[model samples]
Target: MSPGLTADDFDFHLPPELIAQHPPARRSDSRLLDAGSPPALIDRGFRDLPGLLRAGDLVVFNDTRVIPARLWGFKAAGEAGAALGGAVEVLVERVRADNRVWAHVRASKSPKPG
Candidate 1:
């Protein structure tokens, strides 16, 4: 079996503007950032992925169920009808109460409750 990684060792920070809030022109047009254990990070495009991989390679996936907690809410601009729409992605960390939940939100800008 492989060695286990510590929880703290896997911490990563992603800028809000860099988040995928909007769909790309093409799925393959997305940019890929290499955050692996290399001395320097190499920025590459998705088109290069197919050429880099060879046969007989195995990829492992997490068995955890993914809950689509994607939410589209409008930010409270001056008035009600003039509000702007924004994408907010929330990852449930824990449940505090029946309606209260601890979560991490990623957005292009600060998201406000409608």
Candidate 2:
């Protein structure tokens, strides 16, 4: 099976303020969508789950639970004589084989290898 897809293949735009910073107040209150073959639609609360599933259907979940590995820091930019202040936001996605961390970083400038 082919594995890699370019970032352009899965592009999406979301407003910054719309992103949820934390989990829902109640897990069972979360909405679930059914995107199977026929694509059935339902708008019930999470408690209505057992009545929706069948015998052999698989239910996959993210087992790699999220840890608070994201950090917000700052960096200095511009030339040494004209160092401009900048903000940086970082999220540690996973640890790599070489003991380096794969991360998603947001800043005015791109990040560089240490």
lDDT of 2 by residue, 1-114 (tens): 997899886588969986668878999876655544455655566667777789997878777766788898767555676565577899999988998998889988875554
Backbone clash tally (model 2): 0
Note the Cα lDDT for every prediction shown: 0.71, 0.75
Q: Which ten residues in a row have the lowest lDDT in candidate 1?
A: 70-79
Residue 17, candidate 1: C-alpha displacement in angstroms: 1.5
**Candidate 2 Cα lDDT to native:** 0.75
| Lowest-sum lDDT 10-residue window in model 2 | 34-43
List, residue by residue over 1-114, the lDDT tens digit for candidate 1. 988899987789989987888878998998877655487788888787766567986767588875665545544554556665555667777667687877888878867665
The TM-score between candidate 1 and the true structure equals: 0.43
Could you tell me how far off, in angstroms, the CA of residue 48 lies in candidate 2 after the best superposition? 1.2
Candidate 2 Cα errors over 4 Å, as ranges: 1-26, 34-40, 76-85, 96-100, 104-114
